[model samples]
Target: MGRLIRPDGLAVGERVRFDGQVRLVLAVTGRSVTLSDIGGTPRAVPPALLFANGDFEVVDSSGRMPLPPVSLLETLPQAALERALWWEGHILEVLNGLPPDAEAGTEPKPQYAPSRSL
Candidate 1:
């Protein structure tokens, strides 16, 4: 079993939520965190704004969480966010049943359609 990662413990290539957007951890330092969107583009937000009221999560890549929902826009795309949330809800259901091995459906990745050239 692997431990879940969190924002304060982020690493290179890991994901973190800022405002409603999901940003990957490009670099971390003693003073601030630098982030990029799912499309691998740098955002213009001040590094300190990450502390604002919003949900933060470390995108799991252990093959269980296929929908890592790391967005770049100020507000994540509604459809993409919904898909990620639905997968999370299913996870909760399995945890409550104690049948941890029960596999979740092979859902498509929750990333939004890219609007720019990478």
Candidate 2:
């Protein structure tokens, strides 16, 4: 078995091939890598799926190859942003159950409230 590679280490705009398909490396981390499909959709792939190193190339629409700076936040689309926010909310809910920290002794705010009418 191959060791896992950090997805965040991959150069932005670096092309890579995985599972017999080609994709652009958007982000890399120790556990997984984020890639952009040919259609420009971002997908997360585990290191196990990455087979060949040079199987892909970095190229733009003009075929000129260049590596872009890694910006994970910039790569997130509206839908992905929403999903991340939702998951974060769930995590916060779990954290709220724990005892308050020394700095702050209040619990998290309620998620929902009864609507008041005039």
lDDT of 2 by residue, 20-96 (tens): 57666767676777886654567886665563343433333232123332254457897876676566555434544
Q: Which regions of candidate 1 deviate over 4 angstroms? A: 1-8, 38-41, 44-48, 61-118
TM-score of model 2 vs. true structure: 0.34
lDDT of each: 0.52, 0.51
lDDT of 2: 0.51
lDDT of 1 by residue, 51-107 (tens): 443565565423333234444322667886777666666653453432234467543
TM-score of each: 0.36, 0.34
- Which residue pairs of candidate 2 clash? 6-28, 6-29, 6-30, 7-27, 7-28, 7-29, 8-28, 8-29
Q: Which 10-residue span in candidate 2 carries the lowest summed lDDT?
A: 61-70
Candidate 1 Cα deviation (angstroms), residue 107: 34
